[model samples]
Target: MALPYGFVKAKIVSTPQLKSTRRPHEVQYHLHFGITVNGAPWDIAVNVGTTDADDLLKYQLVFDFRHSVLTTLKSTSPGSTDLTGTDALPALDFLRSDFLAKTGAWRNSDVMDGSDQVEPVASLQRLLLRAQQSSLDVYVFGRFYSEGDGVHDVHMNQGSRGEFIHHAGDDSNDHNDIWQDGALLVDLGEPEWALYAAAFDQQYVPTDDLGNPAPGSQPIS
Candidate 1:
């Protein structure tokens, strides 16, 4: 089953809030933000990796992203719109869309939940401040909640590995798909857009048509 992928173009209404998961079954880590769509409250839950040292699939966040898809994302309308089967929207595909440069793009140090450096967290804090101060619009791509109150899974959605290869007793990896990857894009001003892409080190690329990892696929890290 394909996740109900979609996009939410709205304005940031609150600062970034860090939530630490205390349970084993909850979303391990996320940077939540308050947003409004046509006067209705909505939440943007961005995965920021986990603090667990035993977890093999750590987070990888790409900052200052550059790609031609930025041009198409600029013209998107406001509010929430489902892109499950639409060709007008730029449904992201990290491996196939040429969204990521082939060289000098991946760094061994890019992480969202590190305590040593004031990097990604610092960068995201600054982004939220600017977005709030300037009232800039943010484009969030993910699966909207069934209740229609928020959006989550704002990260790469393909090429699962290890235990992620199956879900809901479905051995076919029902959650994975192409052109339905999640992302967070912000429009700063004319000719300037902020694209943030993230994925776990375990998710590989060059997925098949059904999003299963190809025989010789490479990890996104």
Candidate 2:
């Protein structure tokens, strides 16, 4: 089974940092942003596309994610909350829920044009910066650390394949689960909240209840 899937309701406390711990020829890049949950330091790790001239799997980005879950999230307490059981907290499911609209809504190309052609990193940074400037609370939907002070996998957690599919000796994808998708939502005040979501290029939509890709599954183009 996957780790405890949940969300962290907090406020941005510091500027975002672009960090990479991968070795040469490896493409593991993340945007590490800082937030304070109930006066404690917490990290938000968001995956981004690589600028390296490699043919690794690129990441897909989506902004302005809309869902009724935001209404419930706004009422949650400040700190880490486990959304594992049947509760009022709405769990995110990228393929099963209406978190996003049509397939074309996914942005995998240039987010900006001309001189302002910023990568996913810069675009996410600007979003966080705006939230910080507005002093809004950030609701991070993902798996909370079981041993540390942070939340990772803030992206689409379904339709996983290959190495991402956790093998439990019997080749079963233990990591696959419904209603545990990850995303980030910033409360931009009444009727206006900015959301940030991402997914790997290899991941496909129309996942099954087990979170596995169903027949005719297609990637967001």
Candidate 3:
């Protein structure tokens, strides 16, 4: 199934939920949401877990939307992109923090929930709390259904080489052709804001979209 690239400006319609499946063979963590837009209803989820692609890289980035965070984001991701969610954002186009500082891992010292389960949702509540002040600009790739409705793959879309994820090529003929990037932007107030971007390292080009590749797509072998 191919999910197109998209970005939506929306507000939280209800309380978000975090669910994790830790069965050895089916291990993964999910954060789901009920999103409210002026004209449409949307369902979005962020999916990340373990795989043999290279190493375990599950993480969540949260920002406080302070003046300092805003300055960094603007200086880093100054480029304006279409919300179609079809673009790949290079590191220069976004903020890149130290692993320990950005990771929401309990072992990594992230602020954890009271449950403190193995796969915990740290910093999630902290960030969503900020959204209470205003609508969030969510970047996503939506899949429209036959009934003119749909859900969104509201997470990082590139870098997974698994054939199951359609990461190998851009042949539209193939149903598995949805490779993209997404993020959440918060407008704290005039000049203060933040962006939460998730991504994987296995991608050849984080900024490449369908029929387009980032300025550099070659690798050194």
Candidate 2 lDDT tens digits, 113-136? 212235767677888888887788
**Tens-digit lDDT track of model 3 for 13-120:** 556566555644434454666665555665656543333334333344544433233343444331222333332332112222232244343222222232323332
Residue 193, candidate 3: Cα error in Å is: 1.8
- Over the full model, what C-alpha lDDT does candidate 1 score relative to the true structure? 0.69
Residue 41 lDDT in model 1? 93
Candidates' TM-scores? Answer: 0.81, 0.80, 0.54
After superposition, the stretches of candidate 2 with alpha carbons farther than 4 Å from their true spots are 23-25, 51-66, 85-89, 102-104, 109-117, 166-174
Model 1 vs truth, CA RMSD: 3.7
Kindly report which residue stretches of model 3 are placed more than 4 angstroms away from their true locations once superposed: 21-24, 48-55, 58-120, 133-151, 164-179, 201-221
Query: Candidates sorted by lDDT, descending order?
Result: 1, 2, 3
Give me the displacement of residue 219 in model 3, in angstroms. 12
The residue-level lDDT of candidate 1 at 24 comes to 67
In model 3, state the lDDT of residue 24. Answer: 47
- Candidate 1: stretches off by over 4 Å: 22-27, 53-66, 86-89, 102-104, 108-118, 166-174
Candidate 1 per-residue lDDT over residues 75-187, each given as its tens digit? 67789878874433377676666665632454332333544233455566677778888999888888778665998878788888765563533635337767777878788
- Residue 148 alpha-carbon offset, candidate 2, angstroms: 0.9
Clashing residue pairs for model 3: 5-84, 6-84, 6-85, 88-207
